[model samples]
Target chain A: MEARTKAEVLRRLRSVAGHVEGIARMVEEDAYCIDIIRQIQAVQRALAKVNDLVLAQHLRACVTTAIRGEDPEERERVLEEIVEVFEAAQKI
Target chain B: MEARTKAEVLRRLRSVAGHVEGIARMVEEDAYCIDIIRQIQAVQRALAKVNDLVLAQHLRACVTTAIRGEDPEERERVLEEIVEVFEAAQKI
Candidate 1:
């Protein structure tokens, strides 16, 4: 990963960790369940943005490299990996 | 939340927070994007489980109470809140 993207991704993930902690606190305090669910939803959305950032970079750099390279096996592997990611993402 | 439910929710949330930090570490290490995305997906799924746990408790306890109680306004509020939660969850 590029240093900048790495930093941005790390930052967002750390914030996600904070949100998770917040949810735990809310649970411990017996805060409203609907409220906790809302927080969980927010964290999931945050993680999705992180996914998009990482996926965009992957497509721009690694995937592009494999596609433009002469190694058919590498290209095929990357292609399969992306398909699997998207399928799993749909489940998410 | 009930004692057991509270403990379980907190435990799962702590695990999710740990996973988020792990993903941050992976980003810092410049791990493969697909691998990081897989981790993120796992975290999201874990969060969903927590949501289910909390929602179940709410329905079994709080929602059940409101339905059986005479507070029409509280019942209406909970119903609206649940609708909003499902709407947001669909977006997730």
Candidate 2:
């Protein structure tokens, strides 16, 4: 990944870490159900942003390599890897 | 996104299109059940790779923006969007 992109991801992750900590604090304080739910949602959103970043990187790097490679096996392998990640994400 | 990354995604997509065509041919020719399953698996794998690429980008851009923005609303919006996408993805 490019330096800028990497930096962006790291920055986001740092924020997410803080957000998650907030959620933990809320839970500890015996926060109301709605309040807890809201915090959870915040964390989920942060995670989603991270997920998007990773997906873009794979598309640019792995997918490109697979498509341009002369070796048929490489192409198939990359495709397989991509599909696998999607499947995993779906499960999550 | 950078030009190289964009090019990579496009290239991968092109190959996937070809792969899908192959699968269509297999189905058309009354291929064995196993053969059809294999093709489906191949398609799934290709899709997964693409998903990964997109996820990476979101983490880098959207997540970073949310974290850095001073507005609390922007941060909340980004987080919500991320969770929503992941939930949708799971359903699929």
What CAPRI-style quality would you assign to candidate 2? incorrect
lDDT of 1 by residue, A8-37 (tens): 888899899998998888888889899999
Shift in Å, residue A48, candidate 2: 1.4
Model 2 spans > 4 angstroms off: B1-92
**Tens digits of per-residue lDDT for model 2, A1-92:** 87877999999999988888888898889889899898887777777767777766655556555545567687556556644555577655
lDDT of 1 at B43: 94
Stretch of 10 with least lDDT, candidate 2 chain A: A59-68
Q: Give the Cα error of residue B70 in candidate 2, in Å.
A: 43
What C-alpha RMSD separates each model from the true structure?
Answer: 0.8, 14.3
Off by over 4 Å in 1: none
lDDT by candidate, in order shown: 0.92, 0.69
Report the error of model 1 at residue A41, Å. 0.7
Instruction: Please report the candidate that would top TM-score against the real structure.
Output: 1
